[model samples]
Structures are given as C-alpha cells and as structure tokens.
Target: MLTNACAIIATAASAQIIAGRDASADDWPGMASLQTVLGHSLFHECGATMISPEWALTAAHCVEDARIETGGRAYQYARADDGSLVRFGVLSVAIGAADLRRRGAGTVFPLSAVIVHPAYKPEKPEAGNDIALLRLESPWEGPVALVDGLTVVPREDNLDGPPLVVAGYGRTEEDGPGEEAFSQTGRQLSAPKMRLQEGYVPFVETEACRQQIDSLVARYGLSDIYTDVAISPDSQICAGAGTTDSCQGDSGGPLVYRDYADPPVQVGIVSWGLGCGRPESPGIYTRVAAYADWISGVTGLQIAAPQP
Candidate 1:
C-alpha cells in the first residue's frame, strides 16, 4: 500500500510507517497518536504533533469528516451519501504514550473542535492544503516534558537543507490490501506498531521529486485523477532516502527539520506518496511553512513568518 495520502490510479498510499526504528522513550515529547474507539478497543489511526497545550496539528484526511461550522462550532461526524450524520467512532489524541496499551495519566485528550483547511480536497489530497488542527476539550495536563519541544514555525529559506525526522505509531511494514479495498470498505487495513517508530529522510528537490513521481505514473501506465501538478514546491515537501521512508499509519505526522543542537522545527505534515519506501518514489508532505498565516488566523496564536 502507498503510505502517504492519495491513491494514483492503481497506485496507492496508506497512513503508516514503511521502514523505521522503534523510538526511544524520550525521543519526541510532543509526538501524539490520533486514535479512534471501536467497541472496547482504541486503535491508532494517524500520528499528530501537539503544537500547544490545547491544540494539535495533523493531516486533514485523518479526521474523516470532523469540521468547524460557519459559526465556529465543531460538527463532529461524517455524513452519509444521503446527508445523514454517521458516527464511526470518537476521535482522540494520546500523548506521552510510548506503548499505546499502557497510556499514562493525563496523556489522552478528547477533541472538542476540528479545523480542516478550507481548500483541502478529499479526493485529491496530493494537490495540497492537507493540514488541520484539533482543539482539545481541555488544556493538556500531561507530563511537562510532552510540551517541551512543541512544533514551531519553520524557516522560509533552505527547507531542503535540513536533516529531517518523522515519528509515528503507524505501521513499520508497508504491506496491505490495495486502495480498491479501502473504497469498498470505509477503512484501510492498518498493521500499526504498538510502539512509536522514528526515521530520518533527506528532502528531495522539487523538480527532482516531480520527475520521479511522473516516472512512476508512466511506468505503471497509471491514470491520475488529480494531475494538475504531481508535486507543488510551494505547498508540499518531498523527502525519502532509499527504503527509509514513512508509510500507512504515519499520515498527519510531523516531518521536522532537526539539528542536534536545537529543538526540531516542524516543516511538513505527512500527506501522501506513490508507494511506501520505494527508492525511486519519495513521500509527499504538506508544507507547514506555507500555511503559517492561515494557521495563525484560525488558532488566534501569533506565528511569525519564516525569516530569511
């Protein structure tokens, strides 16, 4: 399965990890797990990053249909084809959870509001504007360490120059049923890891990323529903190294620019990729830096524009 977002014709992407190592206990304090309850079980669906005590950042598609109303209330359910509200499950985020089964006190927070980018296209997530923010029902009272390295605004210049890190509780392997199966059934099969996983990938230059994706389309004789642009440098970041890349359960997760000496700065949100860990194809992420103004306007928290 493709581990990113959109499915390209017969090509596809899921929400998890492809090839990554198990994250140490203190690797990422702000790292979070986007989960949904099913009967007696809470399953990890996507990865998220806590940006503030009451807010988290994730990919729009990961929230299914949770949206903010015109009057600022959050509508918490997806609608059926006939326009009736459908409650699949309750969505929540878990912090300070190295192993999801052993969630610690004050680590989980129920979401009160969901704000998906207005221009987000569900059918074509790869086209960009794939970011979203979730408001917690109450301020996070988890361990202070969890909020120590909150994601911040990214640098405007040299996005491709930084060493990047991606962490999630998504699948460590990239094996799954195809996208056709997901369309038939409302959900994709997730072989998620119980423990968090982290990996590093190099940022691919925009033109090079586009050429690689185009080559994949031609090689597979595939047809794409969203072909306006395969990879937009202004809205997306492309990064991968050999087979070290994010996969199925990693969507909405942070792709941060990390330097050993300083706190990591989130640069992108995991969106989509042609296939997981394919050397020739790289993962595509929603460029967080590009949406700084929109995020600030929605959150009412001042975020400085990237400086040269």
Candidate 2:
C-alpha cells in the first residue's frame, strides 16, 4: 500500500518499470497492481481487483492521480523528473462488452468518468475506506468474480489450521539504510496463516519496529520507514508472525480466505505492514466489511457472503 508519505517515491520507481515492459493479458492477476499512465509514461500506481469483465475495485488514493489502463502484463509508475503526472483520470464511463485478453484481439475505449468515495480521506492511511470504482471503457467479456462481504472469522475458533493466503507485490524487506533501490514487480509473495486477533491486533512492537525503522533511516536518511504501532480499525486486519505478513507494493492486493469446495474470497485489501515483514509484525489490511455499503453503492454490485 502506498501511504501518503511513500506515495511520491514509489510512484516514480513504478512508472519506470510499467513503461519499460510489455505485459500480457493473462498476467493480470485478480488482485494485481494497477499502473496509471500519461502519454505512454507511467504516472501513478495502486492495487486493483478484477471484479468483473469491466470493473475493478481499488484504493481511491491510487486513481486520485491518473487515468486507468489495462491489458498490460504489469503496472508501473515513473518519477516526476521522468516526465510523469500524478493525478486522477476520467470521471465515469460505462463498461462496453469487450475481451482484450483474447490473442489477436485488440480493444480500446475511453474512460467515461471516475467515482470516488465521498468520505475518502487520503491523509489518514489507517482509516482505509479509501476505496474507489473505475467504470471501464468497455465491459470486459469474460467471467470475473467480486470479493465477498464482511463475515467475521472468530480468531480462537479458527486456528492451527490451513495457512491463509496473503498475496501482493511489495518490498521483500524493510528499506535498508543507504539503500536507494525499490523491489521488483510481478513477484507474488505469500505469508502462511499466523496468529489472528478480534480486538486490537498487535503488530511487531513499537520498539522492534522502531529499531528496524531507525536503522534504515540512519543509513538512508530518507525517513521512509513507517514504524507506526497501531493500525486504524478501517484499514488493517491484525495477523501476527508465524507465516502471514504484508509488505510494500502489496497495497490493494487481497488477503483471501480460501475454502476447499469454493473459490477464494477476499477478506481484506493489503494496506500496510510493520517494518517490512519483521518476525513479530502483523500485516494490516483494509477491512472489506467496514465499507460494504460504500463499495456496493459505488459499483452497483451486491456484496455477498461466500458459500462454504
């Protein structure tokens, strides 16, 4: 997830990568990174969910800066000096029936407009109801699934079981001191099931998180380390160390709960993690259930409970 503090820097790095690659349709994973472009150059970046042939759900912060584009293997954001623009694009557009994924098939349409949440506030990264809706230029012609609505999974009731799948493309580790590099793209990382909590979820303790954060800051002097101890109720699901963790570039990806007989249903959106996957740090996710009404109202899609 690109918090306000790290948004600018990450956007630049990502733009370079997006413009340099030739991504394919099949590479568009359900919950993948979305790169915004301006005149063939990457401008901004955010995570997106492929909800339907023509629709994607993502954080408002991502689209707040550029126009939406699809069909590329991956999304990239470029820095301002690289001639990139960081701004939202389009207001609203209907989804025309088209299938860009088919080989030898090329489809192009203009976005009508963008619909952002009325209450979305970018400053508060924790109050992560920062959701948004993108009306595709044309309706995608294929099968797409929507994420499931909020349904509580009791922490103690479900434990020592199968590992929950937390997927994203963020930094593999905390930003190191004197380090001036970003993580690679298209690399899907997973954290197995760890500890879960009902009330306040504890990430790596502040001291520990600070140690890593301080170390990076001292070396890099960039102050990129986000060692915040608490996550707001709106944005994160407290899952402690064992296996499950979130990292940079993972924002907007899904923290899915998969069942044997049914497909995986997304329970949360990758929002942030403590000190880049430290041993005790639990990754935070934007609570999908908290914004069910907002999500449904904006997309005109119903949020249903997943069937077992």
**What are the models' TM-scores?**
0.82, 0.57
Candidate 1 C-alpha lDDT tens digits along 42-63: 6566788877688888888777
Number of clashes found in candidate 2 = 35
- Kindly report which residue stretches of model 2 are placed more than 4 angstroms away from their true locations once superposed: 3-29, 41-44, 66-111, 150-162, 176-235, 240-244, 305-308
In model 1, where do residues sit more than 4 Å from their true spots? 1-14, 67-85, 142-153, 176-191, 228-230, 305-308
The CA lDDT of each predicted structure is 0.68, 0.42
RMSD of each: 5.9, 10.0
Please write out the lDDT profile of model 2 over residues 1-308, one tens digit for every residue: 34335442221011111101222223233543453323422211434566765567665555555443453222222336565664433232111111111112222223444555676664334444556666565675543434655323223222124334554334433342111221122222121111111111223333444454345445544443433333454444544452334444445555555543566555556554434434544555655666777766766766564458
